[model samples]
Target: MNKTLQTDLLEIESLLELVKKQGIEYLNKIDERKTSANVHKAELINLDSKGLGARNTLQLFNETFEPTIVSSSGPRFWGYVIGGSTPASIMGDWLATIYDQNPQAINGEGDISANIELETIQLILDLFNLPKSFVGGFVTGATMSNFTCLAVARQWFGKNYGKDFAKEGITEKINVLTATPHSSALKSLALLGIGSNNIIKVNTIEGNREAISIDDLESKIKTLNGQPFILISSAGTVNTVDFDNFNAIKKLKKKYNFWWHTDAAFGGFAACSDTYNHFVKDWGHSDSITIDCHKWLNVPYESAVFLIKEEHSSLQVESFQNSNAPYLGNPMENFNYLNFLPENSRRLKALPAWFSLRAYGKEGYKNIVENAIDLAKYFGSKIKESENFKLLAPVRLNNIVFNISNNRNKENIDSFLTQLNKTGKVFMTPTLYNDQKGIRVSFVNWRTTKNDIELVFKEMNRIINIIE
Candidate 1:
């Protein structure tokens, strides 16, 4: 064995202790860390013939890279709909890495870690109060979750015309109708060979709303002339957190033969709170739904799930089954994840979510989600009263999207956001909403509170005052 490897193996316990101490210190001071970093460049290091021991490598990382790390998982970092890791999730993540288990087949040669994944999915369903008819699996994140669901939808569409698209390729020009879909869904279409540009755009509700207009949707369906299609709806839009009228969509589903899918991502957390659950009412009626555990469930990165009704299990298998691998057994009789989702070899990605759900349970997540909604409303109220900014739309859920109060110039919006982010105390994202430049602030982190909101509000006021 190499000298460094031997040394690391001998001192593994001490090395882990050092790491645990450092992790605790960082978590202890996360609130004090900058939301944005001033450093942009780092010198690249070349590999040496001899590897550095783990302790020395840790020292090197602390000296060269640690200072540049930003507190993106901290409460004040609101640039995207990012969520901080809860203690329970971090515990699960560490265990997952240590175990290094691949949760694939149920009847595998190894232990059935996939049972943990299955149980975790059920926990998530319970958290959302969704029906047991929906079967789900974990994936990397929002994009892959959307891809997985849409892939099955694509197969269902092909089946409607008595063709197997997965085996023969997508010979049909598939129809996709959506109002204000996240870019990830469009990218998934491009990845699935369904041309992104080929989508039939549905009109959104008039006057500062991102939800689809029912009248426009039905009229667009009329143009389809009874052809089967895929309907991509948003459970929570990125810019305004706007939700489609699901009750109305449920009515349409009875009359139409199209497959329904929703990209709920972070917004699906609304189902956790009784006060906010109406935004996602009838959402379970969707043939498939995508929600990110990393976002609102407050798990680590690269975690999302796709819930598809059990009725379409055959389509899922047809779309993702690996027929070439005879050793994996039949895809139909002996079920496994390798023949289910996009990736063949997947880590026990559901472990973190499992720990988080078990740790918090339903009421715990309800409190986290409701608290975020309260903070978002508090922040939105401040924005509405501020003379320097005006809300582009009302705070319907946990996001605040706004524009310069008296200035419509794009440069002014850019300058304001730049100046605000430069404060390094808070961060927000710039967006284009309704053909106008805007800024978006989302609240999903568990640590965020009214204090954080007040701090950001004061920072915004100070920045605007200086600019004025």
Candidate 2:
């Protein structure tokens, strides 16, 4: 080993202790941390021939880069459906790095990380009140989760016409139908060789809603002329958090030959609340589903799950199987994640979720979900009452889509959002809804509270007055 590496290894205990102390301090002061950093320029550093060692490197990082780190995980950050990590989740994430176990095989030569992953999947299924007939695995995020599910959906579509797209390549035009899909799902289509433009847009429900219209959806299916297609449905839309009528979709599955997939990333948390469970009623009937642990489970980044029905396991293997490598063994004989999902090598991505689930249980998550929904409603009420702002859609769950009250303020939406984010007390993202400029504020962080709502309301008003 190099001299510097050996010296660093000798001081690993003290180095880790220093990091732990810093982590605790940062997390404790997160509420006061700025949610945005205006400074975009940084001094680029070159690698040194002689190492600085861990201690001096830490000092250098603190001096040069740490100040630029914005508190996206903080309570006031209501941008892009982000969520903060729970205490238990952070603990598990730290351990995952320390262990550095690659979770790929169920009965491998040595590691059993895959077993832990399987257990975590079961825990998630139970939390959502889903049936055991679905087999799930962890992926990087909702994008990859959607890709995994749709890959199998693609294979299944090919099977309906006596073809194996995975083996022979896509020789036919794949039919896809959707209404109000998250951008990530469409990106997945692009990655899966299913052209994003190929999606047949199903009309949404009449009035100010993003949910799919059952009557329109049925009419669209009739146009397919008994062709097998893939229906990508949203359990929670990004703009207004609108959920499709899953009960009605379940009824259509009986008559139509199509693979149903729901992108329930953050919205799936509705299952935790009796008051909100209706949003995803009968969603378990979906052939596949995507849920992000980082968004609503309050786990760290790069965490999501893709669940495909057990009956389609063969199709999944056919889509993702590493058949060329004989060393990986038969894809079907010995159960392995390498043949089940996109990635062949993966970390113990399920550990943090496992820790969070075991630490909080169902009641704790229920409280977290309900608290976020309450905060969103509170914030939405404030927006509705404000003279300068108006809601673009009703507060359906945990997202508030709003805009400036009148046409005069329309042109200022982008500038208003920029100024507000520059305030550093809060952060929000600009969006377009129904061809009108708007801003989206999503509440999924467990630390968010009524006090945070009050703080944000005051900040929003202050920013609006200054902008006007």
Candidate 3:
């Protein structure tokens, strides 16, 4: 090996050891008052100041950096549908970094690593019961996944007449129909050529189930005439964790001629469980669906998969895609990475998922998902039993949205949320449902157990009693 390369590798090893020690040390003492929350609400320091070796800088990072992040990987972290990755996934991530494979096309990582991603895509398709011929791409997160799916949907619908709407841009108006609790990623669709103002909000909360009915959806679709309409349904909504009436939406798509897409970012994995499969019964009929492996599958961060109905539908019609002549491709055209993804240079992001799924088969995944649902229901039962806590929305899936109410001190809601955060027993979030402030807990972590749920209930009762 080259002397300089050897030296660099040695330094990396040393740093890894040091960081591991510091990380464990920091995690052990995270409850200290000095340890602050670090979810975009934390301090922003310059890159140089944040780096190691500087006496005070190293001290601050070692003392604070990770400990303060309120990581979802933590045993009690119940915030924002985050998943705790398995050791196998972590090992695969390390290998991905060491190899530094850029799977843009077959030329980047050859057929080996790129084919692994294709396999991951196929696995996701089968897991979700999507069409066998559906195309897929690895993206940064559900935002990019939704963006990619909608981008393809726009091109597919608008370019049906060879109009090239992406390049020419949407000269005519278009509307994306969706219900409340739509994944925030819808904003990405608007940002990407599809006008944000054109979003048609459908009333999903007609009853206890929290799913939008076909009657409401069909009425909305009738309002839009000649304009291109794309119906976006949620497989797992953020607030309620309720799936849209996928079967009803599927039937509507046939009659309306709108491109049907499902944003199953968090709950898509519910399909892995036999019990929750009914939530996404007709999901296979969707033109496209977004699944985030990092969320439900307990993989590491920054790994989400977007699957489309047809392979050719995902290809960008822009210059970059057109520039690369398909015929003169590398030997790995059997499953070239770039043919599917919007990204030219891609990481081996699928390995974590590949490792996790293989380590634990479909049955293993099913158990964890079902356990999460059971935990949610357990907590919901606690809320229903409590005279103080009002179940905000009906317990649908793994997400339980409810508010703690007393004699009628409404302002205490924020105080209650802060108390929960301060105690660090379980991390939850605040949301407005039916114009009322509420606490929402997402049982997305595989580490979560009956004990964890009991602890959360205990802590919540303690806080509610304190306020009372």
Q: Score every model by TM-score.
A: 0.97, 0.97, 0.87
For all candidates, the clash counts are 0, 0, 0
- For model 2, residues 1-468, the per-residue Cα lDDT tens digits are 999999999999999999999899899999989999867585686879998999999998898888888888889999989999999999999999999998988885988688899999999999999999998999999999999999999999999989999989999999999999999999999988998888999999989999999999999999999999999999999899999999999999999999999999999999999999999999999999999999989999989999999989889888887878533434446778878998877988899999999999999999999999988998899989988899999998999999988834677788888988888888899889999989999999999888988887887778777876
> lDDT of each prediction vs. the true structure?
0.90, 0.91, 0.73
Question: By TM-score, how accurate is candidate 1?
Answer: 0.97
The TM-score measured for candidate 2 stands at 0.97
Q: Which candidate is the best by lDDT?
A: 2
Q: After superposition, how far is residue 79 of candidate 3 from its true place, in Å?
A: 1.6
Which pairs clash inside model 3? none
Whole-model lDDT, candidate 2? Answer: 0.91
Q: Model 3 residue 144 lDDT?
A: 83
RMSD of each: 1.7, 1.6, 3.8
**What 10-residue stretch in candidate 3 is worst by lDDT?**
314-323
Candidate 2 minimal-lDDT segment of 10 residues: 325-334
Candidate 3: how many backbone clashes? 0
